[model samples]
Target: MAWGITKKITSAVKKSAKGKATTASASALMAQREEARRTLLKAKGTWSQYDGHLVRGRQFLADVVEQKKTAHTDGTHTQADGELVDIDAYSHAFDDTPNRYSASVLELFLVQKGLMENSQGETYRGPYHFNSATAVVTGNPAQSAAVQDMMEVLKNNEGAEGGSRNHASAMTIEDMRKVMAWSYKQCPDELISLIYSRVQSESALDMDNVILAQKHLVIRAFATTGFTIWTRNFELTKIRRKDIVWNCQGCPPYDIPYDLLQDHEYEIYPQQQTPEICMFTHLRAWVNFLEEVLLRRPLEPDEFIFARVGANSVVYASDQLSYDGVMKMLAWMCKEVGLTARYTTHCFRRGGARYRFMFTPLGQRWSLATIRWWGAWAEGESKNHRDALCPIPREGDKSFNGDHILTAPITAAETQELKMSFDHELNCLSGKVEEVLDKLTLAPASSTYSSPLPAPSQPPILVSSPQSLQPTLCHQATISPFLESASTPSMIPSPVPVDSTSSPSPPAFPTTRALPSSSRQHGTTAKKAAPIPGVGIPDLPRGPEAWRTAVKQWEDPAASIGGKALKDWPEEWYTGPMRTITGVKRNIRKVIAMEFYRLQRDEAIFVEAYPEATCGVKPLFDAVQRQREGRSEITRRATYITLSRPAVAGTTFPGPTRALAQLYLFIRRHSVLVH
Candidate 1:
């Protein structure tokens, strides 16, 4: 009986130990779950404001739609002709009504329905689709004219006399600046002041100031970055206050680190983390805007940065601004600024690209590859898939590998050179415009001055008698200042003194001097010719009519003095031929180098025959030709026949191939002989 009691006691002890182990394991599991929750919450703190705003905005939108439906069923609301009202029009009505919550709610609805369309009738489904459209429209005639002229200049081959001809359309840095200036000028004064204020100040915002503060942030971000409306919206909706880096995720259940829970106030230098991605100052502005303005109160990870404040002063969370709404705002600004050019969201991207290309330091410039990567353009596996759907011949072959090969960073020296070049061009254009303006301003003075006619081909000889006078061959027209400067006595030398013996000497007239006639001449004296009226210094045309006449005279070869034909002078005298020659030489050298390289690939024959051709393949052909010159007479004769055989047989290759084949055969023959 005692042994049985001891066994029972041992069994009881073992049961208790097992139970204790189980309890410990359960406690550890719960503790891990709590830790995980805390880490997630810490990461959530970043995007919490944006997510809350988005959620509230969406909920409010649904409520509005439901309320409308309820009112309609209750006969409290009625439609005119039962027509479907445009959501954009309905949303715009609230702009001046002080119903900020209603406006935001409608915006969320429009965003969800994808009902926003720009002036071009192109639909903007999401924020990313919003591009340069905001800055595209320009109504100012002078600016528009300037932009058109710039476009023409960029698309044409420049002529010697500052004329241009149509070619392919291209954009330039000047064109981009024109557009940007228009946009900048068109922006509201209040918004501009707000942006400037935010950039200058470092003060934190109070809860009461949050609404106005966030608005300022949004404006500042958009103005500084030249980011597409959608990109800004996407970032604002997804980014968190403590999130130092934009991971390119639109919105998130983000990947958070466990250590983040320990230090809630930790921040990182965006410039150090993503040096080449975003501009430093712009990134700082963005971070400050988020922390000091939008995140003044508690927020959820999935909320939007912007929120709606109702007429009753109730603040509601809101989603992003509608693409269409932003476009309409841009259009309003364009109209206000008197800009007439058709602009869209794409303008921002183009302008930004041009700004970076022209103004940024060489080392800071972003390459095409970087743009494609950062912009989420199709590339790598995705690019392959896209290409397969619409295949382009040799598309894959055209792709370059590595950032270094694709684009080089701009250097400080290069930036300075570019700046100087751009400044010079701008100054030249400005000078021309100023000249035109000055002429217009002094219209009365121009009308009073009589324009001089085009000078005669040869100075008219005033005969002693009226019967001896000859009629002028060319008509007299007004001379332009340009023509007056161009036509000088140096252009046409005085006629060689006529042989006095062969020609009869005429009687001297007024203003004429006596010339020494040849002793064998008939008893008469040849007279020195007087200077012709308007020969060297012609009076410039001033008025509009005179200007038109001058232009006509300048263009017409028949009207010009000295019997010089217009066809003799090419439109592009100085630079055209030089460019053509440079291009031809470059192409020829490239072809020759390629052929020589190909020949050298035959290691056995190339090394044995042209041992001295180790430096480069280009010198190999010259060495072979030199060796051939020293060859026996018979061998030279044989080579000539062999080289001529292909052409004689009508089987010689054309272009670079023909040249390569001839060289290859000649080199092969010499190599065989040497071997």
Candidate 2:
């Protein structure tokens, strides 16, 4: 029996030794693998580890490397050339380092202050928080003993808290709330209950709460709703309240609520009742009112978050204040209490606009069904389903039709007149009255067909003087000089007449007429005259012989001179893309249509503008071709011009365009003419 027991004990000892050896070997192998992963991560770059495990670190590193390799292979990494890389292996190797923020917290002793609590149910403030023993307390005498003690400590620590120290400012309403909210986690139950009580009472007006609310709205509107408020022209109603409707079947709603609020057209101002204005600007107004009536210490130029009270002024006018004055206020308020990177009011406008689309109903945007139902997407279709749809305002650009100002806060009659004016402006051709009339007669109802019905005609308007219709004629006069200069070279000296009966009086087009005595100096007046045939006045010599003898070859008024009015125009000129068109055919057709129409429009505008030039097509063609080739020279040119142009000056196009147009005409026309 003794011998058998001994044998069993011996066997057990041997097995234990083998198991220990295996465990050591495994641990060593793991350590070596971890080291190797770290090395690889260091090699690949951009590897950072969050969690604290060697294995996890290596895995994260490897993931990063794999991502990097994939990016390289997929042409996403600009620096990487095509190479078969072990993406997974690279990722596993790189994710090993600790986070910088976590390290900063430790270094700054933030966690200690974060965890500290007082018997009065108060907690240690963040880095910005000063103990009664340290701070120089001001403003309210009702501060607690704890706060007093904090101030005392701040006095002793004045060396650390300098006058210019950014973090030394008092806690904002927003920062205090954030700290209290965050404090609840580490706080004892009794302290937490007290904090909640303080919050409930709302007696303590903290900057943190205001900032928190603004941030919450920004997140909700921009990050979640995927829709944003485009225009904030209202003082009373700033909230973007456009919601998407599911089964909405009525006429589209306008943004009139906000518009009216802005214009103060409503009886006694509905900003108080309007929900959109109620959201943002009202808070500012309330704050301003409080500061005036209660606080007595009015807001400074940079103190308020919204444009109310003292905060309302342009940055240039403010002189000393920054453009983002509200942001600075919010930051000062938030950081003092312990929060970071809080938002301001303007953040909502941009943020909301960006994300508003996400919350919109799927078919809210102009689509095939919308086009069919509306006959055309004339900016009103977005309002069709108002309940659940928030339509993003399509802003105006050189390319697309933007928000119609016709829907703004004018009377219905005024709106109608405005609409008529808008239609006339859009419908009219660019030239003399007779030329415009002739063009209108030839123009098709839709540009897609060759011999379509003619566009609607208005009674012939006169071309009296430049200022006859409108006294100033500022808009027209702005472009007149360029046209005049362009036509200079085309000028031909009147043939020296043989007789005196040649020239009639230079067509007595009336001059731009002045307004009545009661009318304001710069005000406009309507004038009427018979339409002249050709725009450019053929400069005739003073003698009657000039007009009679200078080759009066009458041409037919109805002659087709390849003026590119509207024959077989592209379909895209009238409609957006076709919905049912599928696959490559759809893409190709649409691309071709867009390209062709762009080319045609550009060609027509340039050719008509510079008729004397031979290679008029070259500039337009090159510009369009580069666009099609994705070379993007036009954008670069525009961006460059924008960058180079003076900020407080005239239009960008008129300057460079005039120069380039002249250059093109001079080179193409003069060069060919000389040759």
Candidate 3:
């Protein structure tokens, strides 16, 4: 019995030793894999991890080689080159070592803040790494006391948000509206014909610049597409060729025959047939451009889509589209469009999310659940985090359809008009103006489309006269300039959004849609009396003489053409993307109104003239407060009972859109109580 027991014990010891050896070998292999992964990630380069942690979770790829979405071993991250990276080591660089990081949470904050501060002073050459806390930069030790100090700092930041960088300002609906309008207004030539008219016209001789301009258009295409689909920059960078499911149902009937996307697999995520910034539309066009135009045909299954397109339109398939590269294009485009914010790639995620939640037409806006699923945010994630991303305005920021909730109180009757205005704006948000979009948005993309009262060449019933500019507002016979053009009800046309395909070429189109003409000093007007054939929202239609003056004004501002009345002034202003954008139209009108207000103020005729409109002693109360927030979105729905020829200044706003002439007066007189 004793001998049998000894034999069993010896066998168990041997088995245990073998199992321990196997475990040891497996751990060693994992370590080896981890080191290899880090080498690859470093070589490929990191942007989100370094760019102020712009995209969440990307910067946390230190402990795990490839950052995972959940607390699991199966990492979700992959390099742009489609390499798998799942290792339990931070071997990215010696600088990436967690020595300083583990010291305290403060170290992480210090790293980001330090890098941001440094990058601002010097031109950023590449992805920056956080250095260990040196004598120059100190870090509090990782202790309870240190953590408490950090909490205090966070509370202080929360308390003082005006000057705090604790939160990033997400793209508001107004910003999106303006940005999209600008994108479409600028990219029409490039989007449709794959060319930049303005750039080519300006730098026709400079082939290099022309090519670079074309390349920027391609970037614009990608930016617009990604924003519509709510895609992260990382996801966009690594979009596999296989995932490009092309559903070319309503694609422009391009007669140029090509196998477009021969054997491309289907993707269920990207929708089809939808008009507004359809992801499939952009992607299919990109693929078609590559296959038909550039002859970069037959995209491989594992290949990245946005590969670098070189000077000769050469598709460098080997080079993947990096985050930094996309950012450079975005930065240039943003500046060109006059966006003041320094938006990072995360803005796309934030912008789309906010648009869906706050800006999508009233009842049609996405619910919190849909937003969570669409944005890849966990259902149970911190409400604060989601709020930060899709910030709901509070106190002074609260607005609806560009009107302050308290100051510019919308009436029940005007509520439907406001809803319709948004519906129109959202319908043509992409500015496509295609048949599908036209059916969807109640607006046309083409120039031949109809608007009952065609956009005027200048503001009808012009109020200003360069000097004095004091105008009669409450006259019975001079109310023609405040009426919303028939079809527009206050909104204009749908703009055709911009697009590019990572290709270098030039696009031509001058995107300047300020309120033109009617200002006698520094403005020119178009001259056409036979009903201009483009979408416009003039207060009233202009006559032959008005049209003639506009034509002379536009053709020769110096009176070189002797104020000649030609058949038409020019089609560019009336037909460009700027005309479609509601914001641009509003902005131009705002400029004109502000100009009139300036002159009126100079003449000291504001309060004295607006006796009935002024709310008691607080002269021009609502105007100052209401215009303070969303002044551009001021409504033109104010009652202008008589739509007759002007008794004073001018007639049929063919010069400047006089749609807001009454609103300016209303601003001066109405003393709206804040809700």
TM-score for each predicted model, relative to the true structure: 0.24, 0.16, 0.35
Which of the two candidates, 2 or 3, achieves a greater lDDT against the reference? Answer: 3
Candidates ranked, most accurate by lDDT first:
3, 1, 2
lDDT at position 414, candidate 1: 69
Per-residue lDDT of model 3, residues 595-622, tens digit only: 3354454423543433322343122323
Worst 10 residues of 3 by lDDT: 434-443
The TM-score, computed over Cα atoms with residue i paired to residue i, of candidate 1 is: 0.24
How displaced is residue 495 in candidate 3, in Å? 29
* C-alpha lDDT (0 to 100) for residue 75 of candidate 1: 29
Residue 54 lDDT, candidate 3, scale 0-100: 34
What is candidate 1's lDDT per residue for 323-345, written digit by digit as tens?
Answer: 66455544654565455554455
Descending-TM-score candidate ranking: 3, 1, 2
Regions of candidate 1 where Cα sits further than 4 Å from its true position: 1-217, 223-295, 298-300, 306-318, 336-339, 345-366, 381-675
Residue-wise lDDT of candidate 2 within 1-675, one digit each (tens)? 334545654786799866753355888768855665665445423344323344443444445456677657753333235534444333323333544323332432333334442322334233233348877543334355677799988767765655233232222323323543433332223322232344445544334333343333322222111112232222212221122111222223443222221121111112232233223333333333334322345544334223322322221211322335434544654565455443444433333333333322233333444332222224544433222222333334422322463354656665565566544543341222222112111232333323211232332221232212322211111122323222212231232335576753221113223212331222342343322111111222223232121122112212111112112323432222211111112222223234444446364553354332233322333333345334331122221112111121111112223243223322222222212
Q: Following a full C-alpha superposition, what root-mean-square deviation does model 3 have from the true structure?
A: 25.5
Alpha-carbon lDDT, every model: 0.37, 0.32, 0.42
Each candidate structure's count of clashing pairs: 32, 72, 30
